[model samples]
Target chain A: MTTGVRRRMGVEERREQLIAVALELFSHRSPDEVSIDEIAGAAGISRPLVYHYFPGKRSLYEAALRKAAEDLAERFEEPREGPLGARLLRVMGRFFDFVDQHGPGFSALMRGGPAVGSSTTNALIDSVRQAAYEQILAHLGITAPSARLQLVVRSWVSLAESTALLWLDGRRVPRAELELQLVHDFAALAAVSAAYDEEMASVLRRILADEPSDGPFTDLVTRLVGLAPLPGSV
Target chain B: MTTGVRRRMGVEERREQLIAVALELFSHRSPDEVSIDEIAGAAGISRPLVYHYFPGKRSLYEAALRKAAEDLAERFEEPREGPLGARLLRVMGRFFDFVDQHGPGFSALMRGGPAVGSSTTNALIDSVRQAAYEQILAHLGITAPSARLQLVVRSWVSLAESTALLWLDGRRVPRAELELQLVHDFAALAAVSAAYDEEMASVLRRILADEPSDGPFTDLVTRLVGLAPLPGSV
Candidate 1:
């Protein structure tokens, strides 16, 4: 490509282009198996120019992973003012649809080889997962965020992750059947939450009462308690 | 080691000994990272003898994994004829307790490293998970299994796997809190199953009316129909 054409492209555009190309490459092979040379060759750019954009393959991989995560999180974050159950079903439907459309990307994230040591890929996914958890907590009208919320969140996300992978792997279960099963699963989960909320609330109260003086650990504890069944649980 | 000592140990004893030693080594490190030489060295046996029992490292790793899985499955299969919810909680509790004690084995399986291909691990876990699923189905008195059962089995196993990993990795949630949450979660799951059963039974009745001939595709269709909700309504 001409230098003028390259010069006209802003950083964001170039980054997006690089991520698009890298994602395409990584989709076909494990991230470790894909090399900078291959990526640069595929993008029709020099190795130095690729380095100029991303410090290394690790950075490039992180950027691509982050982009994919952002895409996923955006789908879940679509505004909806409805009952918690309805909203959850809508988000789950979107999630299943996203997985169907981006099977390779979803597979790579869930079953990829050892990620490039503590990169943004994990943090991005964790942040999105946490956001989803918070959404559930909010929907529950959980007054105090408790450890129960964390467990429930973890359970739901784990279920969603495994189901998506199983379906993508060509399991015989139809999507509509899977969706209805999920709806029932979440409803049951909600029922359990209702039963245990009071007990969790008592635990949160005790934890708050026993709170220590200020520090990061204390902040964490306070935040956790806030998330518990008590007011300001997080 | 004396010949007398070796002869006294039966084949079962020797096989168990080999598996026990192999689990210790494999759990601490990836299969590729732990060489046959190391396993031999640790087991106080000749490398050739270790090879005699297990053909290769891959076989050794698979044996270790299978042994761990069998141990876990056996724990779940322990006789318990209580209410379905209570039986499930007992089985799940046993699962969590096992993971708490044997975190390394569970982590290794969850990591699903290069040594164990996805298909290999999936096949291994499938039988073990299927046993638990069958138990649940039997308790629910659901005849004629469906693809939905597979999804439920997959999701439940995944929840247990992810929870154990998170707990092992030192999630701040206290152990007692975690256990309580899981019990509640399982209860919710069972409630959903009860509701789904009603929907599935209605669907099954309708499909039975058509009475398709038995064939591979018919089996697939039967499985699919069994998984879905009734056509009339929930």
Candidate 2:
């Protein structure tokens, strides 16, 4: 009915509009489930016009994926003004926001499974992961991360990723707790590495020195310390 | 040359032989790269004979995947005797052994991407994860895991999966250290939950009590405790 008086749009505007509509539809369900007619119907355009803009559904899906990948990569960005733990917590909050909002799309992107998992799609997802990695490195202020540090950072990134994917499934735990726990996870991972490598210990010390008493890292320290018995008191 | 006077195999024996040959070839490369002709040639039989055993390539691929899944699932099994950390280390050793030996096959199985990733394939992969999860819970001796414990265990499993996937890419880190770190990672993940949850804390205490001084969990505690300053000296 609304198509009776459709507003005209430029080529680029129409393309952008189509992608936005497709992204919205794909975010709610699997791309395989959504049809081009449905996409055009939602976008208030003809089905043929949808193909006029893109070769096929796969192209449109890839376009939507590219946009999602960009948005997700930016979720890792935070102002470098606070303690590392707090900064990471803020990042996790935003990261989870995206995961919560785009549950299906996030799963498809992260899983890289049957739903249009091309080499290009894999690269796009990898780009998002790489962006997050670089942003964390920037926050850590490290130009050359040691191998153990790389393992810690990379492992934490994967942990956050899988955490988001699993969280999306049932959301069994509270979002706030999961976000803070992820921050704690980062610290715990680095602390383990620090215990093994002296270079990592120095990195950890430098990061911990700037943390506030009430920061997540300090909270982790307090919690872990609670497990320890007092020297000569036990 | 051996085809001149090949030994005759029974129906069941030939079927098993074909699957073994297919698994060997698929494990070496992606299933897409290996064709029916190749499978037959590898099996020292004709392509039609390969089809006689199975309907098509997809069925054979699924059969091979099923076998691989069972083997991978068994990798998590260990005798319940040693300290938790040592037991986990042994499990990780076997896990990486599979990952290291079956590099391409493991990637295809874990990624569940283009290499014949049917729903059946995904179910098989999930079965392996469930098996690993249950095995870890059995090690913890918990029939009813709290939400937080479940999160820790599942998160550790995902962490181990991703760690192995990433490790396979470049193998930049030493295999032995990565295995130990994964054991440490399980403790680290559980320790964080124990920090927040009394139930997890008690479980951690029980596990830690059984751990020897040089065990991985004990090593994690010692390493983390070293990061702390003296109560009065500092």
Candidate 3:
């Protein structure tokens, strides 16, 4: 292992290796609790060499965060095929997969850990959220989102975030149900918005038109019907 | 005012005065931006006199935050009457009213400003959220909340928080609509959970039984029906 550490490696390879090591370490414990020395030891490199690749623990944490953010953002990207509800459920599965895999790091990034209030850290998290929002818009096939539509999308994004954070505290709720519930949550948010705004109503209409009879949205409707029949409906 | 400041006062009175002054200053701007001298000036007292009452700015901020937290927790208190929807709408109104009045302070409190990640601050905010959850459960007239019921209530609390934070960024939507929308968001969140768990379904049934035809929950059901009529109905 020592010989392997001494083996020739390109600069980019060395940086990526260090980031991977840091990410693995940060995954279990908070970035604050993890030390640069521990990272160096895990990477089988000297402390000086670790600093050679990254300036400090804060920088390394940000790099790892950026990587996690990118990976998490990609999770939100599902193929455009299939019903909207199914696509969202698939996206949520991958989203929670990332959250489960990168529990502490995800919490730190979302809850503002070492770089609390840091603009760069904020921008990275915002980018991931933006990616999710844009992906939803693309799925909706809406070129321009109305104010209410934007609100609905942003609110769902926040809901998913808070839900994941709370779930991370204890794995009490089953992950699978939470994933489908999130898909339903997205529809629930949009449905409420649709009731208030004509633009949102049209958006919801287009979404429902594409959904199948057994999708998560339909499941939500089925559950709602069990509570009470819609008044004035035959 | 300056002469009044020079007059003798009880120590507790002076301390309370300082906290109030700091809170007023922090309400407009982030606590980090506010200064001890400014707090003193606002209270018509010298900087040293301000120090005489409080140890430092951080302590003063915490004191002010405690006050804000108490006030915010109180906002969730609504007499259980009429219907849950109207009661929740009233709670949301008061919640947003506090948000509107204490924009920066509210942001700081929720987003972890000045004392970012401080346990005291975190506990204070958590206490407020806990208060909200308990108040909601009390309104539902439930002593033992199921896991799904807990999830629904907690998720609604988080939704309300993010909604207020976003609304504070830009007063885009009408306040009245946002308030009602938050109520709808709560019902929507609960509705989704109620669909999943039988425990939640019964909770929903009891809630619906008391709600009037024109209540927000009924409004949500009406809106949902507009999207797509439930299949095999009638």
Best candidate, lDDT? 2
Q: Any idea how many clashes model 1 has? A: 13
**Model 2 regions more than 4 Å off:** A1-6, A228-234, B1-5, B228-234
Order the candidate numbers by TM-score, best to worst. Answer: 3, 2, 1
Query: What are the per-model DockQ values?
Result: 0.16, 0.49, 0.53
The estimated TM-scores of all candidates read 0.62, 0.93, 0.94
Q: Candidate 3 — which pairs collide?
A: none
True contacts kept of 1: 0.27
For residues B1-234, write the lDDT of model 3, one tens digit per residue: 356545787999988988888888989988778888889889988999888878888789889889999999999998888898899999998998999999987876666633544667777888999999999999988889877788889988999888888888777888889899988888778888887788887877887888888888888888887686565652
lDDT of 1 by residue, B149-198 (tens): 54555566667677777777766666654554555454334334433455
Higher-ranked by DockQ: 2 or 3: 3
lDDT leaderboard ranking: 2, 3, 1
Residue range A107-147, candidate 2, lDDT tens digits: 76666557666667777877988999999988989889887
Q: State iRMS for model 3.
A: 2.3
In candidate 1, stretches whose alpha carbon ends up further than 4 angstroms from where it belongs are A1-15, A21-63, A78-82, A108-127, A134-144, A167-184, A193-234, B1-16, B25-42, B45-59, B78-82, B111-119, B138-143, B169-187, B193-234
List interface RMSDs for the candidates, in order: 17.9, 3.1, 2.3
